[model samples]
Target chain A: MSTTISPKNAVQVEASAEVKAVHQQMLRQQRLNRAATYAVAILLVLWILVPIYLIASMAFTTPAAVRAYPKGVLPFIPFSFETMNFFLQSEGIIPGVINSIIVAIITLVLSTLIAAPAGYATSRFLFPGRDFYRLSVLAVRAFPIVVLSIPLAVVFINLGMYDSVYSLALMHTALALPTTILVIGSVFASIPFELEEAAQVFGCTPFEAFRHVVLPLVLPGIAAAAVFTFVMSWNEVFAASILTVQNRTLPAQVLAVLGQSSEPYQFAGAFFMMIPALIFIFFIRRYLFNMWGQVSK
Target chain B: MNEEKQSTQKKRKKINWAPYWLILPSLIYLALFFIWPMFRGLGLAVYNDEAALSLQTEPSRDAATAGTLPQGTQVEILDQQGNLIPPDEAGQANVITEVWYQISAEDADGNTVEGWVSESRIRVREENEAGAPTAGSVRTRIGAGDTLTEVYSEPNENAEVAGQLEARAEVAITDQSILEIWYQVRGEDRNQTVEGWAQSRYIQVFGETNTGRIDRGNTGQFTTEYLSKMVNDRFFWPATITTFLLMILIIPVQFVLAIVMALVIQARLKGNSLFLYVFTIPLGISELAVGILWFSIFTQSGFLNSFLQTTGLINTPITFLSADTRYWIIIAIWLAEVWRATSIVMVIVVSGLQAISDEVLEAAELFGASLWQRVRHVILPMLKPSLQVALILRTILALQVFAVVIALSGGDVVTVLANETYRQYSEFRNANVAAAYAGLILLISMGSAVIYLRMIRSQEEMAA
Candidate 1:
């Protein structure tokens, strides 16, 4: 085709040159699109980093330095852990942190335990009321914990279980359960049923097949669900506040004492509360897309 | 063949109920915790009244003969049964009783009069002197201005001009003050009857004229002052409402920002992988930490004003924590929330985004489409299913927003649904109204879910 075009008359060769120019213009536009993408990337990074920088600086500053008006951009004085120590020594901080960890763990375990098999059932079984079950889970997911927590508080009081960590865990489980079910259901659905059927052919029971074949295949998805549930439970405050008073969670304790203290103590408390979540998020960053995709769909 | 068919039918009857068993715990938990409490709370809001528990009443015959209650009465105590004993008097027989009863009466025009009726005036029905029915009736003394205040009246020209003519006219005079008489005359030439201070010399007394008298005490005016007093008495109750308003202000803003971030990330732009990681970092940060972070920047002597001053943007450092600057603190918290929560949305959206087949995009690209055209026509439509889920989840979470706001604002400028519930359970020690607010939140969440379902259905139809 190139040889044929080369031997063409002068007027026809001019037409081919015009086509080449159009192709060059398309190339230029593609290059411009790439530049625009980079610009967006840069802007997004800056948008995310600025607040983080502010928080880090505040967490590190000394009490006097933090209180000083017109604080220098950099920590002008040497950073100290005095604020953090103050928070650690404050009333309810240690217990609150411990309670938060315990509640989150229990919530993670219970939600995963209940939601996994149910999620699997939802994905695999062609049962009656399947759609209803899915819709009901969605409805539960939509029910505000604030509204639910108030009534739950009363009920707990009546049952003589108010202000207990167990109640907090229960409420947290309720909050995280819907997402767990949905994510695991989607994860299970993505894995072929044929694998389970093949296990059945090897003389395994239905339960055994699921335990070996389906569970192993969906482990990544389950881990993602666990992480999501943990973060949710960790971050939760309203229900925790309403549910527990003496045994407050970390967020609740911090919140209860917010703005009541010196700037350094407040910053230190905030910084400490955020650390676990940040570390957890970093480790599980890759699964975020998968987890979100499953939940959203 | 018949046996084989029968055995197959028998085997089919043994269906697995394990799924039902699996969901049983959650179902039981919901039924006991959510559904039951909801109905109970609703009952309290609609039916129960703490004030009504103290009210007591006794049976009576004629409305007028029932008691000696006068108009415009104010007393601290109602009828005390113990105070009804007769005093020693009247020819060695106890005739005077000391019963104290709160009596309220209203005239035909609906103006209420209320006062304490003495036990002596309240005569119990007894057999007549000759076995006929008999009951005691008290004649109330008219005071100054005690007559019906003339709301409206018609004038009689002949009566005003000293003509001795009978005219159908309405006259109202109170026992307290007959000096000010209100008269409405109905005649051929009727006009408004004016109210004036009548001279005592012009008055004529008649025995039967007061026969239709209404036994009433002075009814207090329902003034703005009284209403305000009532509200003050129940000030703790309204705190729930304030808390709800605060929650509404903070939660939805965070939710919107979060959803937007999620959607943008899910758009599958280049370098979103790194962005997703960055966004998730705030999830690890505690609400207190997020608050402190923003506080560091905005406090009077913090980073923000310092930066501005160093850059010569301001003449002096500004105080950000003052009462006046607290509103800006709320905005800073909002930014913190956006930073913290957008990752959640991003995660949800990205997952949803991935579920969309690449083939769909390929098909659109093959059809000679621009990137915008592909996103508008191909991606968004496919994203609807996920968007609905995201919206429902985000809204529920948003309604319960507390920690971030509390941490950031130190519970000063920010109040929310969750915060109000906390205040009720903690500060005021009133669980009932707090539960009521919680119930309101539940209603909102359920309503949103219903709307979401309707939206998703319509979107589905549109897609189809």
Candidate 2:
């Protein structure tokens, strides 16, 4: 009886030990997986951030450092704004910036104003041709700006608006409108119809319900859409380059002379073009998903 | 109760016109700006603003002008002279010998006139007054001989050999003539019908249409000159090839990276929010900035060289952006595009992943599926719709890639479709050709969009 019991206990101990070893191995594998994931995450982060950091450094570096061989990877070893200042002082830079700002603002305002009503109509009302309108907007949104700009330039020249800020603004508005409408439509759609009905139930008219109840809630989304529109206009080089000559936007101005420009100017100009849009993007980061979410759907 | 019924009836009878009113302004604005410009843009491909070419009185540049020959004018070339147009500053003159023809044709005002016009300004075609090949105009056949006649691709003698027409080979005359010697013909070659230019003397000639009329001027109305010009431009194919190359190289990598990024965020690990923000930082960065950033990396003495040298990886900084290393330039542009544009795809994937319920993934896990299996069988299947949308968006945007190519390589070493359009419009001062490029891009965009839709829909049907 003692021999049989001892052998069984021995077998049990061996089985338990094997199970413990397997559990430990699985844990190790999980840890390695986690480590790999972190490594990948970090690598990706660095991949994006490094290039930006290098450019920003070049933008802030002295002209000499910018032109130096085997340039520094880290930022601001001897930080200087001489290159940036030189770019700013360069001919046409100031006017170019001003034009870009003005065109962006006009585009933002005009596109938002035009799109908001359409956005509301699509979201709130079950109107005839609603599907048609939405699809058309989607189609137009994807229309090549390169194609649109050439003919628009001709029309503008015929209308005597070519090479002017307003013509570009109009083109930008056309570009921004479809996106604005789609984005704002999604923004309006996200709000419950019951809220507007509640306002009406409390003795408000349809317009009053929209203006007071829906408008306040949708403002942030519209602002997000407006920011997107502004960024679009600011970064649009093709149409701006084609449409304007003397009153060139910042991108157009930079691109026109980019071939001949030195290293310092190119880096500084790139940084300058990037900063405002980045700031605007940061302000609207919370709404990034909100803007693109429905557009994709 | 009767009053309530009447009011309800009134509400039902009155149509809701408010939505139409709301959408009207945008619709009209789109019509005027979006729709109108699109039609006009496409129209610019075919319509020529320059209606007529002045018929010079003689072959000399200083010769007095005869009445204008409207574009598309059919003229009888009674005489001909070759003139040498001097080369420009770039020494890239129109290398084809300039042949001027003395011809009689109706002027712009419909009055018959005799004039000499530059051959470059006209298309040559055989007269077809009877609207049929006419009597004795049997299909032209190669003259009987032991030797085969050489068919040229272009009407010019110096053009490449397209094919050889066998002796006694029956050919259809296409009514097109050029260089006063070559006739456009379609004939059977190696059992394949080939269209090419054959020397007129090598083929049997027939009909009073024997003397082909020269198209001295383009009919300014509905011309294909711009479209042809856009296609024939030296930069056109390179731009097209580069654009497609970047698209093909960048897209799959983007989708894969984007999926990984989405998964990383979805992992909900530590600092996931920070990862999300960092991954998306490039979203707001303009393409021009992205180009410059990559240029700084790939440029000689830039960060890449600095890192390589510091690590003792290389003895000298490589010239990555030069014309000789055009492949590197393309890689640089591809990297820039992947870096800057992947954020959008990542966001879309993240949103797609969000729409997918965790229950499906958990079920797969419960079924003992591994992580790879779970992703392949569960997550990816559910992510198709979102992936389709993202693909369409990325494809259209990829076709329009411009500023990045310009910034990285000055657009001279490597060109893309959008860059060529700009060059044609601005530098060459030809809006029509630019418009032609634009029209091509638009067509490609629409075609890809349709293809994506069709492909996904078919897949869905198969599943259903």
Candidate 3:
């Protein structure tokens, strides 16, 4: 609202003083609001990142420094891999990691395989029981893990499948299936149904239409769902601990001895568990909404 | 016309079963793993394993004793001596006579024992019955008692007391008394090969075979003792109250913080996607790791203390995770939960915010509404459904908070429902009590969900 009162136009100045002052006040207020927003946003970013950074420092530092009081916030002065290395070399760590990876892979395959067709059916077919199925899936998605794991553990043991990685994968699949179906269902819903119809009209069979036109578009979202399934299984500790004895997953293994483990082992173990998740989220950052958002709706 | 009418009738009669077929596997899987276990957990909460069978050497009532089998023991029927009576229209007794079967099974010592078990003693294992205890894997705890549990060399009370083991000691079932009153157990001593016998009543037999999940009694009779035990536990109220308190404290703060973060991203400022990524980073992190990460911060000589000391805000590092500082432990857990979980809420909120079209916000801006007014009037109302979803999600998860409390506070100073459930299941070897805790948690979670649903529905009605 600033008016130019140059010498040539001095007799023709327009904007009132009150209006200029009000405009200036409004601009200042907007600037203040922007600064506040940035401040809050950056503070939140730090809130999430700083703990991770602190744990990472503890992980990368020498074991001696990890135990020292008034510890350094950063690991740079004499960064050492000693702590993380010690954790990795420790008994059962390798086996635990192997078990975690296997279980996650199995869970990813099983959940995605089982949920894909269901997701497709719900999104496309408009079947009679579709709403009931979808609502139940939604309900089951929020089921407490404790209730499911304890009994399933008993069931697995009865079937003589307990303490095996795949048995755990089965349990993890059950946990992830509901969310997977909902997410993949929404993914399918996003693709236009007429595209599949057009492919069929062009002489592609229904299956051929699905395999060629629709599959290519939805594959990434389904893969993201699968990756999340893997992450869920990888990050889960309670069920893994309850369901398996010898075939403990990484989180369960770390938790099993966390009470007796030293500070370095604990920190390094936490950092190790967090690494895949951090990277996985980075890759699937585009589908964060696709995975979680539509489910909320 | 007749041909066309017939064809139309045929077309009308046919039903599409393709979608049903597509969803069948998932439905069955949920039925088995989700629905069945929930009922099984409920059953576990209500039942205790208290049934046993005495194996007679002969079919006669006066026969000599051969061995004993705990309920749920798998035995192969070698011979039968009586007819199976059918239930009549009057609903009379199904067994007309005392039936007996000669059965063979491996004993606790891996030796096969052959004996006559009466029909009344053995429940028929249904064709679809899941696997039973493989004859010798019974692990029981010495039930609560202050006095030392005296173990006899023989099943008889007159037999010499071989040793006295401490209460709450775990023992493997090596043998059982023929009279079904005592169990020969191998106690905690490592060097002792031959352990002694303890009375069955003093031995608390939770249906945990050596290598399986906790099972309720195979006898199929329900009991309220486990549920009562959970309710009567010393830590029950503290854990329950703390669980709810944490939920109450954490969820609102989380929603607010999440909304702010969501708004920041929605502001479309420079590098907001980077901010979105940073905020959602914790969505991938596990609760156990989050607990450990925060433990590193709040531990003695940890990051928080280090920072405070470096800045001269404190002279010495505080013992934040100790028993005397229980509130601090709770705070540490609160902070950890907030840090780890708010991201989920933020993502949901951001999506909800995105669904609000730009024109509505522009309309509000053109109407000269303040930022606060726009959020209060135009934004939050639109965000209700998302908020409801986030609230329910956060609350349910908050109830099940386990490792964070344990990791930060050692679970001694502060406890939650899930921790108590784990303690009952793993440490105490009491599956029934653990199931009780799990059932209680589920109940509360469902109650909260129902409440949230109703609240939102009512609010929507009010607005309508």
Candidate 4:
């Protein structure tokens, strides 16, 4: 074979072998990278999920299950609805959950209504007080609703509106307004101004252009803003606790009755409050950056 | 067509009335709800609301407060606002006005300190005030956080003990002896109506003072008593400092975690969005939910202790949420907050990272720069704006921290300024101090925001 093989052929065969070895090494490296990626992804997923799993386990299992010396992380033990049923059937909880929904809805509507225009104004046109408006939105961050709710409580009482969902909704709107305005403004800004201009050139009035062209484009962002506002209002405790007496939101009610209830009720209540939030978070995943990223830019 | 188009154009081409109109609703709402209330809160904090009546700590005319209502003493006011509501009926007997304050408040903070009237002198406002309780029956304010344990089945001093009653649980007396040392009482607790024999001497009995305490009224928005309560409230300084510290501590750590998370998610790997979705799932959970969920882990006999005990780490389950180890409660709360809110920073960082052009990174790599060097010189500088935003927002939100602590601590052993503000209004019935606390929080939050804003600005942006 050595006699039959020319030196050039031998050299070519050696080069081909080298190329095949290099290709094999690259494939192995790629597989290693992929394995690393999957490991990290799984680790992160578990990190995010394990707490939720523990909570869900507690909520679904019996009180004894929670007290188990070695607590089970998963809901593998026979499921029991007794805790959740008791919480759901409890007198204060139903109205509380409903009031939370109502308050959140009101917050969403009010924040969106106020923020959309304010945001649109800031995004579309530069006015004299534009910087002031922008800075003030940032400035509102300085004051917690805790401080504001005190005076608002008094005012709401004077207005004969204290301890009602409306007063609470109003406070929530104020809290939600700053972020809504900023987020929605950025949303509108991201849409090309040329789109609205194009609509106007085609015989649409400016308002008509916004209503038809700009609005549909910004709806998803607005929806995201609405979700954020809803989550905020739903989760809010301080203002709800302060501003209302009889008509308490879920978090406020939970705070009020926290000590009185048993542990199972606590877990159930906590898990119950999370149900709507879980659903909404899935809806708003794409818009989180749209909501938060604009601030930094 | 030309005329109509010209006319429409003329109407549209004028000053942009649109933006101002668009912004009006927000301005009006803010003015009505936000700005006005903030100003009023600050103003109300300084002004001493005229006392509906001057508060007398001792029920005597010397007007000495022997100082505020003594804890555990109860007052049955024939009239709460003796003469405040209807000035025309000043000093006159109008016994029907409602007592807006609690009837049997055990907690001193929950007690509205009107003026105190000594025993037997309460009906002195009138020859026979209709407001006085019937001859034998008496009102009682339970002592703050005191458990009325001896629920004897019989009225006798030594009877079979029934199940005990909880704190702040109240009852009406059906029968009692002189000085009411032992009384027959009944009250409802959750599912059952409880009848029990209790001793006035042992239990925290608040009411039936010969003279009632009157809250002249919150005439002076600022009262010395109110100020003292605000300063001295158990939760005041501790909560305030905790809130400040928690925000300060968590912001840096949260930023680090967020960056790592952002880096991980930005790895150009498949299913990275799933990571984003999972990580930010917590963002959706309310503070109440997070706190409660974590509480199950940290409580005595909870998951952590359970795990510890199972692993033979200790002889007994540790009470992590107990007042003796309240610092651990704060740590648990910090854990819950970090777990729930770090994603907010992560999302912002990811957005910032996403905005960075890969070309620049490749160029930096092309310059023989190491990953650390490139990250320091390029990535960090560009990520500054995002970090600043996350820092400012998180700090502001953290300063307003309320629900998490409430869920974990149950308003005991731990408190924050926001929680104190709530206590001032709801528990103490003092809105002025509540406002002041809020104002302080606002000042701090704004100050922090200003610091972050100034500190993190890029040189070019700062120069410009």
Q: What is the lDDT of candidate 2?
A: 0.79
Q: Write the per-residue lDDT of candidate 1 for residues B199-221, one digit (tens) a residue.
A: 11122222434211111212222
Over A56-160, each residue of candidate 4 has an lDDT whose tens digit, in order, gives 877787766755665653453858886678778877898998999999999999899889989999998987788888878867744677778888888888778
Supply fnat for every model shown.
0.69, 0.71, 0.72, 0.74
- The sequence of per-residue lDDT tens digits that candidate 3 reaches over residues B360-446 is 998998788998999999999898888888888888899889989889988767999999988887788787788899999999999
- Which pairs clash inside model 3? A154-B213
Comparing candidate 3 with candidate 4, which one achieves the higher DockQ? 3
Estimate candidate 1's alpha-carbon lDDT, on a 0 to 1 scale: 0.62
TM-score between candidate 4 and the true structure:
0.73
Lowest lDDT sum, 10 consecutive residues, model 3 chain B, at B210-219
lDDT scores in order: 0.62, 0.79, 0.79, 0.72
Better of 2 and 4 by lDDT: 2
Rank candidates by lDDT, best first: 2, 3, 4, 1
The alpha-carbon deviation from the true structure for residue B281 of candidate 3, after best TM-score superposition, in angstroms, is 0.6
Please give the C-alpha DockQ score of model 2.
0.50
Model 1 chain A poorest ten-residue lDDT run: A69-78
Error of model 3, residue B103, in angstroms: 23
In order of appearance, the predictions have TM-scores of: 0.69, 0.76, 0.78, 0.73
Q: Which is the better candidate, 1 or 4, if ranked by lDDT? A: 4
Clashing pairs in 2: B71-B218, B71-B219, B72-B218, B72-B219, B123-B215
The digit string of per-residue lDDT tens for model 4 on B1-464 reads 99999999998777777788988998888878789889888776766554333224332234442222222222333211122134233233422222211122123234322211112211112222534332211123356354333344443334454334333334222222111232333333344433333222222333554233332332344446555666786777788788877886788888877886887787767877778788889888888889898998898867887677767888887879988997898899888888989998999999999999989988986676865797789988888778877887888888777888887887767888877887778888978788778877877877887786666555558768
Each candidate's interface RMSD (Å, one decimal) is 2.7, 1.3, 1.0, 1.9
